[model samples]
Target chain A: MNAYIDVSWPSLLIAASLLIANLVLSAVLRLGMGRRLLVAGTRMVVQLVLLGLVLEWVFDSANGPAVLVLGLLMGVVAGVTAVRRTSIRFPAAYLDSVVVIVTTAFLVTGVSVLGILRPTPLWDPQYVIPLLGMLLGNALTGISLGLDRFLTGVLRDRTRVEGFLALGATRWEAARDEVREALRVGLIPTVNSMLVMGIVSLPGMMTGQILAGAAPGDAVRYQIMIVFMIAATVSTATFGVTMLAYGRIFTSDHRLRSAGALGIELD
Target chain B: MAPPVDQAPILTAENIGCRLDNGWIWRELDVNLAAGDRAVLTGPSGTGKSLLLRTLCGLDCPDEGRVHHRGHPVLDQDRPRFRARVMYVQQQPVLIPGTVQENLELPLRFDINAGRITGDGTAAALLSRLGKSVEFLGQRASVLSGGEGQIVGLVRALLLEPEVLLLDEPTAHLDAEATECVEKVVLEWVDAGDRAVLWTSHDQAQVQRVRRGPSIDLGSAS
Candidate 1:
């Protein structure tokens, strides 16, 4: 038997069994939760297949412009998703927020690929795509949660806000409590996940790297880098969105335009 | 800095029109509450009397017109400044989760006019005026009855020393004795020149009590 077969087949079998068991249990329970699992699996299969084809063609493509176009498209999709997930109206500041988050993610991914890790090909799909994707995913989640929580806090506590306003507090002053509360909630999930990482969970990126034949030390090092990148990107993006969106969402009169009118639909 | 104390027409709403859910509550509502005017806004339910009071204080924006306080337009940036000089008391009182003094001082602490206003004498006097001792300041708001709470809410607004006071159904929640006590305190406070008082009341007795000033019947306007 091949050495690779001994290492890989059992892992592959376990993964297949897990997927099958998840589907079977969901169906037997007749709960909608299992449906989401199946949907996620289908989406993962389709997205990976399409990405595989795209990377195969991109690897051989002669034009540098095609790669640039792909990166821009990815950034645009990420920006739209960030705004959409908050379900709040985009203020002019949101454009700045999107630009900041996407640029930071891109810069981080570029630094990892070009300066530090320096994989075989600078634009190698194996390394570059996943790094950028992870950065975008974390940034999007952080900013959206921050924005939603901030706005919800302000809208729910009208009397408290009015009391502050009537007391000679500026718009920002009245919103100060709500703003802090929102930010704390936004940061909690990320901080908790970071704290429990490696002890309670073997994060996906580390596990995937190990499965792909990377040394355990190398996988852990890459995982640490990813964690740092995610924390930094999330902090920056969430702050940027909160600061920018706060201006548009409230009138200078200190009255909030209804949160519903913002036309944002969060998932 | 605080505004000039003796300015005329401390609050004014010019041709104000407000609509709620496709119904006009009030339209072309004009009012000029000069310093120490001590006016009362009386109307039947659903006449937009409360909306008019809110508009004058810049708490609610009118679709058709503007509100000016002491010559300053109550626009967005100027709102906090304007609100500092005015106080809007709602029909239902909402006391912050704290002791009486904490609830009373809530606005002052958050407002930019903190140093300019005095809460010490006001809290003590207000509690006494509403038939409560100064010791009540240590009591939590959750312990107050409806009559006691409304009186506390009034005292909280009074503590801010707002030049223009907007009261919405202030006495509706009070017993006769508490109502008289609150009315006596408010009227006495507004009696001093340079303070403007405009209030809304469903109780005809309140209208009669402050009957000396011009009464705008919003029900007839509609």
Candidate 2:
């Protein structure tokens, strides 16, 4: 039990039998979620299985370029997910999110891998891919939360912002409060998770490592390092995306662009 | 305080235009506010009077023409300074989250107002003159009535000693007594320095009282 327990296809099928409970509940309650649950379950298995095959090849071959490309693709996906989650949107938001995510993900992960871990070859897929994956996964939520707060906040605070502008406050001066609040909101989850890191429950990364037979202390250290890296990535991406969105929302003349000009859409 | 140096108009608009989302509100409009000028911007409710005042203050862009502040392009390189020179007071006063004094003091903290105080006049003095107590400064902005908010907004702009105030029905929310007090304070403010006001009023009586210079009528616009 202390070592890794390999799960074959039959074992995976046994684990998946848990879905039967959901199906049974749906039939008994006449809940309409059965088809949705089935589709979602199918998606998860297919996506993860495909990921496993791709990850296996990259790890075995130790292909550096493939890891970089895959990491960028992950960032692109993360960026799209971040924008999609926002209830209100402006034009070219996808571009802002993608660029910010890719750059922030690379910058933070590269610092951790090169500066902290000193991984071999610097671009080693084993170290690079999973770290980028985890950072993107977390940064996605933070960036989305930040972008949504900023867009909706400026609109809601339109009068106050323009009031400042009317009296000679620069655009930055006018909107700094909203920007500060958005950053605070986006960082809340990361800060809270950090608060209860060890005492409340074991983190997912630590649990996974412990299950794979890494020493408890080693796993704990790794989790701490990764969490710190995630905080850095998330904050940086959130700030970057919010500032970019602000640039788009306020015109060069410093007027809050007409909502029509922004082509704002609601999800 | 001194007699005038250049004697240029405090604020100027040349062939300006404005547009709403659906269509043009007005176009090829020209208006100016000079020292001792008390101009009126009159239009129907939806005919773009507020937007015109915003354009003069550089808070909104003019669609077709230029705005000048004391002989310089108003919306050019140093817009904050231009805005400081030409203030816009909203019809319904907008205050930030804080006490009334805090809202008034926030704009004075801008780099444009760094060391730009005009006189020994204080916000307390202004408020008391408007029949509000010195304690009014400490009142929460959220708790202030509509007329109180308008007074705070006016006092904040006057504290900056703006050369021009693009007022959009500033007295609309005030009762007759407060409106008289606001009009007197504004008139005194204009008389005290080389300043001007571009006023908008739905009330015909206030318009008659305040119109001492040019009038911008949007009544004819279709």
DockQ for all models, in order?
A: 0.54, 0.62
Name the best candidate (by lDDT). 2
Query: Could you give candidate 2's per-residue lDDT for residues B1-222 as a string of tens digits?
Result: 422437667776777888877878898787877789889888889888888887777777877888866676644558877888788988776787799878878776677787765435487899888999988888999998888888998998888888888888898888999999999999989888898998999988889998899898998754
TM-score of chain B of each: 0.90, 0.91
How good is the docking of model 2, by CAPRI class? medium
How does model 2 do on interface RMSD, in angstroms?
1.5
Query: What would you estimate as the lDDT of candidate 1?
Result: 0.74
Q: Highest TM-score: which candidate?
A: 2
Each prediction's Cα lDDT score?
0.74, 0.85
DockQ of 1: 0.54
lDDT tens per residue, model 1, B78-140: 787777778887666667788988777676666566565465486787688788998898999
Give one digit per residue, the lDDT tens place, for model 1 in A1-267: 112224454576677688889789878988667778878877996887797788778767734566666666676677667767764444554576568677878888888888888977677666777787888888777777887787666665666676566556787887887778667766776788899999999999988777767788988999999888888877877777777777766677776555444544333
